[model samples]
Target chain A: MASDQKVLELNDLNVHYFTPRGAVIAVNHVNLYVKKGEIVGLVGESGCGKTTVAMSTLQMVSAPGRIVGGEIKIEGQNIVNLPEKELRKLRWSKLALIPQGAMNSLNPVTKIKEQMADGITAHEKISGAALRDKVLKLLNDVGLPERVYNMFPHELSGGMKQRVCIAMAVALNPAVIIADEPTSALDVIVQRVVAQTLLDVKNRLGVSMIMIGHDMGLLAQMVDRVAVMYAGNLVEVGPVGSIFEHPYHPYTQLLIDAIPSTKQKKPLKVTEGLTHDLRNPPPGCCFQFRCPFVRDACRQKPPEFKQMEPDHFVACVQYN
Target chain B: MGGLTRGYFIQRLLMFFLTIWIGVSLTFAIPRLSGSDPTTAMLLTMMNARGYVENADKIIAAYKESFGLNDPIGIQYIRYLWNVIHFDYGFSFAKFPAAAWSLVTPALPWTLGLLTVASVLSFIFGVTVGSLMGWRKTPRWLNNILPVSLTFTSIPYFMFGILLISIVAFKLHWLPATGGYSRDVNPGWNAPFIKDVLAHAIMPLISIVITSMGGWALGMRGLMIGVNNEDYFLLAQAKGLSPARVFFRYGIRNAILPALTAFALGIGSLIGGSILVEYIFAYPGTGYTLYRAIQEQDYTVIQTITNLIIIITATGVLILDLLYPLIDPRITYKKSVAS
Candidate 1:
């Protein structure tokens, strides 16, 4: 049965970056949805609009980048045209972002406790003991000790800093959290610790998450569903198990094949051809140039998303 | 204090004395090396004007002996250094029979009163406005304020002073033109005397404030713009911080650090005074006193005032060094211990 409850819904989302080279379509007619308590992973190579989609969800995209079209509904409320004052209330309390480079994302001059409390006290009236208690509780939730409260950002190690970011992200008990490459900058062991901590926090709170990363292997282990993107298009999306086991799109198949595995004693497969330039993207399927199963019809126009199974979707002419 | 900070404290303490020593030594040496006997020059100029050359030889000999001018250069340097420690600088040739201390001390308060108040006002006003300009992507009309600030800062300080005086003082008659206080008002703690002193300070204060405030405003705006683009700022916005909170807590807080440094380093320039402004306003600040000292060959008064300026500037640097650790906790002086 399809769930009607969705924590976030991106309907025909189109985001463009107006640069000196002209308007580059960063996200083109992309549609994605995250149901309540679901962890959706947006996996793609760099410059594939993975981060842009996440930032657009919170309406946090900076200048020269505009969501020219599309509707972003959080809990069924369209946030595309929301006023700044109203948008601020939705941020952190309803939709928070665990930005990349967790260490540098924090204000270096502020203490961990104070920075965390800033998010809490923004929409609520909590002071003194109550504020400290709330911040400490959230820190404890993220597997950080209370000693981190008084410490400045520079005093904390990279993993500890990432933990503080996680704590800050969930400080207001937001309904949805977007963790963008949260563990990219950490050591292998520390990355596992931080990743596990994020999962524990999300599971404990029962909040939906959109984890964006290029490491499909890590995403497969962590997310319930995964959306694979290529050249600013959602090439394939389905349950993590099916997406990993039976990828329908050629791009998805190539990505999974490229990942190193212990079960297969074969060498890693490398895909050929450069990704289409965002400033001057070719017509028809974005993956047509690099696709192994490219057809004459694929050159006519970009393919629309077609349902291959009950819950799986793929954008390719062959699927249609 | 913690062990890490103790190193910083000790380092700054040593620097404070080192700077003062070098400053004082240079002041003592420069005047002697400039190749002119102060007493003889004074006698030549004053006596020549008065047509009293017959008695000039005796007076010059007596003046040199009294002023210790015949001593060896190195010995004089030592004696002068000792005199600085004791706050003694012989006598003022320009003021005839008056001691150098009497001329410098009276003028010190006027300059301090004007420059200190003006600098503080400029910093507060400039930083607040500049940060606002930086945080918001204002309309095209609002950005016009930046070019105006550039224009004000580009004008030389003294020229700005003269222009302000010509318009506001001479033509507009909105304020007094010259002097620390009206000649009619007696020097005292009374309201009228205080009012008169402040009235005379207006033109010079305006000159300093207008020029410096522009520079500080432009500098702060640049810093704020850079800081606003930092990843942390974007994260702060994403975390749902209010625009006002984000602007103040994150934007200004980081942006103001560079402004604070600029302000501290700028203290040395303040001690030098708005020289031409003081001369034009005829304000009895050290700049005007130094001007008269130069014209009249008053070497004692010149040496004393220059050393005073240097000492105050060195003290300002020491204060700034100490202030860094307090305002920013990241500036630790401790060396990392190798594991």
Candidate 2:
């Protein structure tokens, strides 16, 4: 609610992947913010640009993918266009990443201790016993045993690897940690344990985070705020309660409906149409082709988010 | 995993010995399979040369007895295996009474010095170039120019050696065309001898390195491309470590595992493959010695060289198998498999 309290801000962030065919807009003018000591979930289907947003925030989109516009401000410092030397300093210290694919996130050739310690040493200059003590403490914090320090990634279970990533994310005490699908690759039982570890780490450290995942059920338990995205557009950004209880956008409503429920057996809800070619998105609303309540106004022009209630915003003609 | 187990070590060692035994057995069988003892083959050749020989049959029988060729096949095989175990390949038939091991031992160092140095140099140079070419972060000028180096890969190395000898040695007269060193420089570790040896080695070294490095580059380039896309590589960049650190520790370090295995296999046949190069330059290496032995029908010397090659190759494979876990932690010799 307060700009001064914002720990991380994405202002008009836009990213485009320039393929030989054409430029595909991956993240489009999205503005999101994470306040101190809160977790925000970025939710969408596959290819909806949730991961793109996280990667762009870290300034790490590889070749052929460019952050064409906008600023990623961490602690009021704009990360875009920062020189490589300065950017290196800001990374891990100010912003860290808990990458997806916990299975392969670790360097297979290195020990867990080296993998975790090098990131700290890269940001700060600590070595020898002092560095060793810091890394051991990190392992302890993640509910991993001290013996895990010497083990390789192949030696650890998938869940343990995920926990190690969580520990690494918090290693530098970064202001914001972008965890892309932190629990996507784990099984249900391990997912709960990892999710709990994430919550525990956040509670103890009070660091802001942007958690990227497609699992609505898991996100509902961990995040304080939710940002719903579709076709590279943020359809709704509000309190998790508001987004889950009364989804404003048509797509958001469909997403909530699609989640499998234990108590009530229902036919799985799936939309009939596919997203338009990202290279040539329609001129009007991104969801115009798929929206059940499409109108002439929706066909001619895109709608912007309006404040439906305090701390609640939705982008749709009906909301307007 | 914790590490290689004792059981795994013993298993690999047994496999190593098995390979050597098989190789030695094949060498022994091939000579016998020709269906004539060395003594009889030599006498037959002598008769063909002069059209007559006085007491040829008596001489052949006496030679076979002395050489132990008169023994039964089973006894000879066991005896040959025992001798090979101690590296004792009795005598060169053409160069009478010259111990086969003595001839081979003198030539081993030259082959080792040349091939080991050349392959290692080629690997380092090619891998460095290939990794740069494969990496997206490499400068545009580099990626553009790196492919030109691979043009040499299509040229067989021995052909390249011949070309170098003609152009740089015989034509240009910049280096000696046919020898390990000049006759005047005594073959020792002193400055003059070392200088002469290196000067004579330059053309051969150039031919081997320039032609073979491209293969390493191409292999490493493909590997680096795969490594570039890996999650650990991306995370390495995200961690904000210096570019050099990321490239060496995370990028090349992981990608080079498969390349190292290939390199070791390359070294296994190093000496055997260099015969043509050695013949072209008349270098005093085992390859040259083996070539001359084949021309002169030196059975014991040829057999000794073949056995040495097998031993060297098997040793290379054995060392690679044991060190694989150390280079790539994912590959382990442990049993029961850790999670």
> Per-residue lDDT for A237 in model 2?
93
Candidate 2 error regions (>4 Å): A1-4, B1-8, B34-40, B53-64, B336-339
How big is the positional error of residue B122 in model 2, measured in Å on the Cα after superposition?
0.8
DockQ of 2: 0.76
lDDT of 2 by residue, B1-339 (tens): 745667778988999999999999999999889886788778877888899999988999899888788799899999999999898999888777789889888888888988899999999999999999988788799888889877888898889988888888888998888788898987788999999888988888888889989989989999999999999999988999989999999999988998988887776677666888898888899999989899878899999999988988889989988888678777766657775
For candidate 2, the share of real interface contacts preserved is: 0.88
Q: Model 2 - which docking category?
A: medium
State the TM-score of the second chain for every model. Answer: 0.89, 0.93
Candidate 1 docking quality: incorrect, acceptable, medium or high: medium
* Candidate 1 residue pairs in clash (backbone atoms < 3 Å): none
Clashing residue pair totals per candidate (backbone < 3 A): 0, 0
In terms of TM-score, the best-performing candidate is: 2
* Candidate 2 TM-score versus the reference: 0.95
Pick by lDDT: which candidate is best?
Answer: 2
Compose the digit string of candidate 2's lDDT tens values, residues A58-108: 888876889999898898988899988999988999899998998999999
